[model samples]
Target chain A: MKLWKKNIWKNTILIVFGIIILLPFFWMFTTSVSDPLKIFSEKLRFFPEEWRWESYREAVSKVPFFLFMWNSFKIAFLVSLGQIITSFFAGYAFARLKFPMRNLIFYIVLGTLMIPGQVTLIPLYSIMAKFNLINTHWSLIIPGLASPFGIFLMRQYFLVFPTELEDAAKIDGCNVPKFLIHVALPSSKSILATLGVLAFIGSWGNFIGPLVFLTDLDKATVPLGLYRFMGSYSTSWPELMAATAISIIPLIVMYIIAQRYIIEAYSFAGVRK
Target chain B: MGKKKWKKSEVMWGYFLIAPAISIIAIFALVPVGYAIYYSFTDYSLFHPPYFIGLENFKELFADEDFWQVVKNTLFYLIGVPVGLFVALFLASLLNDRTLKLAPLYRSIYFVPVILPMISIGAVWIWIFNVKYGLMNHFLGLLGIKPIPWLTSYEWSKIPVIITGIWQGFGGSTIILLAGMQNIPGEVYEAAKLDGAGGMKMFFRITLPLLSQSIVVVTIMSVIASFQIFDLVMVLTGGGPGRSSASIVQFIYEKAFRSFEMGYASAAAALLFVVIFIVSIVQLKISQRITNY
Candidate 1:
């Protein structure tokens, strides 16, 4: 009876804590649908009586929502695809290839991770401006294509892949690309998915990249588009919340779809560090 | 003959495979770092030719009061990291109870905030911290407590920012801890139960100690991330109320972009880089010791 009593108490505590933990997001969702005036209505309502769906409709119409989505999709898709292809090949080379200065080059790549990206922001901006890449998706996509973290994660994953199989492939007269594509690529599916998802999620939610490079409203990503809705003098709380929800919903959806892969990526990133 | 040539081509291909990565790092990452370092020693605004001023920028920064204030705010935000991380780890352990029917749903729900862009989170939080009609004030009112000026006052600004940060952040740490929990052998718990250990004792003795490696890693990452926080501060406070809540990064941004003091900004950036480097090395050394034990 004491043990059972303890269990019930523990469960109640967990339930209460969980509710507290989820409250902010719940409130955000509620506020998104609630009327601006009704937000602080003297009689508090946790749930809105009549959902104002127009906030979302107005948010979509005010900004080029589909264009922003397309721009974000294009940038993220290109960056992720390129990052996977480049990081995979480089990871394979580091993990399996015979070459002098391999470890030295790998160390250099790892060292870059410690150097904060903020240090390079202005210089990179200048360079991109010089190349006339500013206001274009290439500015964002090109730099991210060679992600050090992806390379590092992929290298660690590739290192554990069986070398004997590669040797067999070579003996069967398969070349490097052939061996990598036919044997190595198929085996590293989980890690690749993890890397791809991580790269996609990061590229999707990026603000600094689009803020610095993409000056045109039509060229801006979701974060930048949302920024347009905000003003220095005042803010549209309900509309801002609506836009915020819309901007984040796709990421939330992607994360939900690939939760297992993302969880594995977190472990991979955490332990490998 | 063709096979011999193919072997040679394969070796070259390996080098070719890494060329794009090396070039990207060299052009984008390396050059910027090098330029920033160079600019730190010169008196260069964005529009002017950089004149070599050799440590003048560094000298000015040593006496800068605002820089110190920003540093203090950063450290203030950093204090919440360990508290938040451990709380998340605690949450993870509870949800790791497989007997719980909705563990996956609980984990995903907790993790939802982590995936959201900081831009959006910052927007919602700004409203939440509004002095009047804000949810926080209204909620606090229910208890007959006076409303707190969350972002308006210097004294109160950073605390609210830290709260928002903790709310958004704990999810990532929880997920990582959950991953660590899965790797531990189930038999350890069984053995503990056989030895008459209950929930609290087993958790303190076994689960936490076993999870220490992951905990250390999470703590270090969280600390680094917290110190370098930019977006939330940018949107919410603009590091305002007389620079009381300005962070090192925001200070650097103002110095570089707003004030156009590129040389001094670079010096500040370099100083920040050194400070972060030292902190990271110390953190790594500490984590290394934990792992070794």
Candidate 2:
């Protein structure tokens, strides 16, 4: 009976905290559909008295929302795909292969993770300028394609993989690439998904990279588009909120679908480091 | 001869596998950082060729009051680190209760904010803190309190940004700490219980000491993240109400992009790098000391 009482108190507190955390999100959705004029009224209403669906229409039409989303999708898709392929092969080599200077090379890869991006921003921009890659999606996609963190995460995952499977595959006359494709890759679904989701969400939400590299509206990503919209229409709260809501739906959906793997993978990364 | 050829082929394949990633990192990360160090001593605007200035940028930066103010602001933002750590540890303890039902559901709810884009978070909070009709003012009004200007007031500007930082970050930290807590041996807890140690006592004596490693990791990460704060200040406040909340990174961005002072920006970035490098080393030393206990 005493234990039951404690459980009730604990659950009540958790529920209240959850509501407080979620209130801003709730307000965002309500404000998006609320009447524009009524939003600034003296009395704040939790639920909108009058819903205006036009805000969504105006929000998208006012900016090149589709183009921005397309750019974001393309950049994220390509970067995640590239990182997966590169990190997989590199991780396999580091974990399984016997090579000269293998440990030293792996340490070099780990060392890169400590250097923050700001240290390289200026010269990277100049290098991009030299290559005439500025204002192009390649600038964003290429840098993101080779993450030290991804390589490290993949290496860690591969290190623990059972060697028995590889031995069996070798006996069956499997070459290195064939073993990677048929044996290792098939068993790595969870790690791949974890890395894919992380890379996708990261590239999708990246602000500084897009802010620095892409200047044109046509090349803007979702965050950049939202920032531009907020700057131009500071007073248009409803439309701004509508745009903000629309922009986060993909992230929210992705989080919901892969919450377990995302949290586990990230915590593993943190703990292992 | 066949065996020798196979060994050679294997070594070649290993090199082939890692070459692409290594080359990209070398070009993008390593080389640019080298150039950043080189550019710090030279004046280069996009229109003009870079010329050696021989510490002119660094000399000017030392005497610049605005740079000092932004540095102060950056240090001030570190207040969020302790606040975030405390909140994360508390929430993690609560959720770590094995008896707690729907823990996964609650954990996901808390983590939702972390995954959302900072732009969206900034936009939503901007409305929530709107002086005239914000939800925050509405709550204050209910308590017979006057509305406070959240983002516009210089004194209050940093508060909301700090609050949002903690809110967005603590969820991840909480998950991390919880994992660390679980790794603590069950035997320790059993011994504590047998010793008649109360909840708080056990927490301090067992949980905290055992959890010190994760705390160090989280603290260092938080400090690094708070120092690099730009997006929140950019979207929410714009260093507002007379540069009250301007961070060092924001200043660097403005100098680089707005003023086109490439040399000065590189100097500032180099200084930031030095500070971070020192802080990380210090943190490593401290963590090592704690682990020795």
Candidate 3:
């Protein structure tokens, strides 16, 4: 009887908390479908009385949403692919091979994690400008091609890999690069997915990078597009909500498909650090 | 001689493998930082040549009222860190209950905010904090209360952003803390229960102490994140009602891009780096002490 009572209390609390956390999301969806003129009605309706499906159309039409999404996708895909390649090679070297100044170099890489990106923002901008890369996708892709966190995660993953497989590969005349490509990478699907998802999520949602680097509206990413929409159409709540809903649909889908890996990756990073 | 050559080749292979990553870091991160340090000591507007004016920008920043206000605003924003930690820890403990069914569902719901883009969510929050017909005011009105200006008022502008920060951050921290809680051995809890310890006592003594490392990590990360807050401020408030909610990052952005004062902006960025470095070092020492205990 006591155990039953405790369970009841626990569940009740959990449900209430869940509702609070979910309220904004519910509001976002409802507002997306809500009548713009009626959104400010004194009695806030949880469900839209008239589903204004046109808001989504209007939101898309008001801005180049698809263009923005394409821009985001392009940057995210390249950055993820670049980060994986660079991090794999670097992680392999740091984990499986001995080199001069190895520890010192590893420490330097780790120390970069502490330095916030803002510290290098101005000078990087200047460099990009000098190279005439500003307003180009290369500005977004090149700087983020390698990340300390990605390398660190990859190194940690590599360290735990069984050495016997590598030794066997070596005995079979498999050189380091060949073994990495044929053996190690094929077996590292899970870590690769984790790293790819993390990098994609990061670059996709990135605001400041695109905001600073890509000044053209045609080249703006989703976040920047959404921000521009809000700026120009501040009073159009329904349109704004609709645009937000559309922008998040892909992320929501990605999260649902790989929720476990995403959550575990984040927690692993946090706890290990 | 053959063995030595093989060892040398292995070393060369290692260097070759790591070369790309190191070069990228050196070019994009290290070189830029070096330039930033140098730029902070010069007066470089985008149009003109950078001339050395040692300490001038720093001197100007020290005397700038707007900069000081941004500093205060940033410090005020950090209140979200402790508040977020507490909320995350509480939710984590609740979800950690083995008796709870659908815990994953509940967790996924809470985590929804974290996965969404901050800029998009910031837009959604703007509506929620809307003065007249917003959900927050509507909820308050149920208890016969008047609506408070959540994002418009100078005094109230920071509150909504802070709440949003906490909300968005709660999930990540909860996951980390929950992982920490899971790592604590069941035997310790069993022993505490065997000694007739109450639930609250066990939590304070056993759970919190064991979870200290995660707590420290979450807090420091939260602090760093909050310090760099720009998206939310830009989207939600635009640091408005006269720069009341402007963060240092926002200030740097405006200075660098809008005013094209690269030197002054670099100075601000460098100072912000110092502040973060100090806080991180202090937190690391504190966490180290706790872990030792």
TM-scores computed on chain B for all candidates: 0.94, 0.95, 0.96
Worst 10 residues of 1 chain A by lDDT: A228-237
Best by DockQ: 3
Between candidates 1 and 3, the one scoring higher on DockQ is 3
Candidate 1 residue-wise lDDT, B99-196, digit = tens: 66667777777777777777778888888888886778888999998888988997898887788888888878888888888888999999999999
**Tens-digit lDDT string for candidate 3 (A176-257):** 9899999999999888888988999999989998889988999999999999988893538888888999899889899999
Ranking by lDDT, best first? 3, 2, 1
Candidate 2: segments with Cα more than 4 A from true spot: B1-7
Per-residue lDDT of candidate 2, residues B1-293 (tens digit): 34323377678889999998888888999888889888899998888978899999999999999999899888999999998999889888888888788888888888888788888899998888888899888998999889899999989988888988887888889888988998999899999999999989999999999999899889988999998999998888998878899999998888888899998999999999988888888998988999997
RMSD of 3: 1.9
TM-scores of the candidates in the order shown:
0.93, 0.97, 0.98
Task: Output the TM-score of candidate 3.
Answer: 0.98
Query: After superposition, which runs of candidate 1 have C-alpha atoms over 4 Å from their true positions?
Result: A1-10, A232-235, B1-10, B186-201
Clashes of 2: 0
- Positional deviation of residue A116's Cα in model 2 after best superposition, in angstroms: 1.7
In the range B1-293, model 3's lDDT, one tens digit per residue, is: 34333377779999999999999999999899899999999999889978999999999999999999999999999999889999999989988877777888888888878877899889989999999978899999998999999988998999999999988989889989999999999999999999999999999999999999999999999999999999999999999889899999999999998899999999999999999999999999999999997
Candidate 3 chain A lDDT trough over 10 residues, lowest sum: A229-238
Deviating ranges (above 4 Å) for candidate 3: B1-6
Model 2 lDDT per residue over A231-256, tens place: 89444888998999999998888888
